[model samples]
Target: MKRLWGILCIMVCCTGELSAQKAAGFKGWFINNVKIANSMRTLDLSEQPAQLQLTFPRYQAHSYLVNMGIAVILNNNTTLNYISDLNVEYHRNTLTDAEQNNFSAGYGFKWRFANAGAADYFMAGDLQYLYNELNATNSLGGTFLLTLFRDGKRLNWNTNNFRLNNRLLFNLAPFAGFQMQEILKSRQNGMAGFILRPEFSINTSLAFCKKAGPPYDKLLAIFCNYTGRDDAINTTSFKEHYTQLLHTGINYYLAYSPFEVSIGASFNDGSDPLNGRTQQQYWQVSVNFLK
Candidate 1:
């Protein structure tokens, strides 16, 4: 399973810096993901690749923001990770309250620092422009947050970065991050939401790479995130309070190359306002390619 452990490195790749470190120039990466829903019963199944996303980092870095980065994304419009309905009542991003889209482009900035003798830290902000053909909704939004770790790794814009501090060796790498987002504009409506997540993993550094490195090299990573969204918040309509979503995932990365695979599951905590008793759960699998 050494190969499998390498593939699972995608778990600690949350920042993309790890994956980009593996790239040659200008740090770039492409990822494809698919999700499935059990639909409250094992027999009733629905699945979709859901989406693909890529990140490109500029060659300049500053303390306020690391190198500026760009992103392109395509959504397949086939996911229920956001609601309790099988078909969906109101569409929204599974990670945030913003409306969902079929395609999108975005820009972002990052501030990175490290304490070789202690821990690692990261904070970033992102802005996106999105469009959906099916709903004809146009949107804009972004988020800012901080992450904590215990490694001596830094960002490398000229090359893909996979190197991790080998000083600290811990079996289970525990880390957490918090973020807040602004739903600038969603179609013609305004929305609000928040997400909270904490993740943990086993150090799976490629057996061939250094025996010790940051947690990203770990072969297995697991996490659960909570998403709370409300489109009608502070509005006149008292339709419902808000929607709640819980997402759990696992990923594998092969340190030998720039490739990774992942699987995820989600649970909707409320009843679909439209279909009453139709509670839903989702599953997903993803593969990523880095150059």
Candidate 2:
């Protein structure tokens, strides 16, 4: 009787293990990737006699990024992932122009819950730090995002996940938070202006070749930003304005791998009195690794 009971217990344990594996599916892993890229641009927006476009001739910039993260499949119904990256960028223009350098660090977390049928709800958060040489300043900022969607379902003529996703890809995210600095140093006193910056972006990504082995993703996006100082400096008057930044791009991914590449261009029109009516254009290429 004792031996019979032991055999039954073993059978029960084996069954439980099989059930757990079936429920979890193929998920949960950690991966890391490194990225490097070069960019060129021209920015001209200043106020002078005859409205001179103070051309800051084409300059080369290099970036190095290190990303590391882990994702976990909590159950058949939920998933969680986290990532952190460190970025360093350097740029050089004319010899007379001062070289600029920026260092940033970012962290993000995402949580997803699967609903009945083809639908899911997700929440995410991101934080970043910026260090620059132009003003020898440091800035810290963060954003929070929330989303609800039903995959490939049309709710209205122009309302649905498809339209929303496309809008996000080429424009500002629907929900977001932002904060930053205004002035690094005061002209007379060594005072600084701590500013609050808020922004919104919307973009859309349209995928083609669904019937083919892989799909192609393209995006168009637009962003608007505003910033104001917390306290006005005595020597200099503080002003606030808005800027419109536009971008269009294409991205491609290889089969069965986290390797993907993208190419894009950005255009910016200044909306600030200090920046005058400046217009700037830039080109970019990037690689993403996930595993």
User: Would you list the C-alpha lDDT of every candidate in the order shown?
Assistant: 0.31, 0.33
Which whole-number lDDT from 0 to 100 does residue 72 have in model 1?
27
RMSD of each: 16.8, 16.7
lDDT of 2 by residue, 1-291 (tens): 243234335433533443464454423222222322321000110000010012334353322221122212122333233333332222322222223333344444445544556545555455554445445555554444454445445541112233442423222223333434444443333434555545443433333333322232433222232222121222234434444444444445444244333332323222321211122444434443222
Top lDDT prediction, candidate number? 2
Q: Give the candidate number with the greatest TM-score.
A: 2
lDDT score of residue 198 within candidate 2: 53
Which regions of candidate 1 deviate over 4 angstroms? 1-100, 112-122, 149-221, 228-240, 251-255, 261-280, 285-291
Native-to-model Cα distance after best TM-score fit, residue 291 in candidate 1, in Å: 6.6
lDDT of 1 by residue, 154-271 (tens): 5322122343444222222222232223323333333322222222212121211335433434454444434433433233222444544454555454442433333433333422
How much is 166 displaced in model 2, in angstroms? Answer: 15
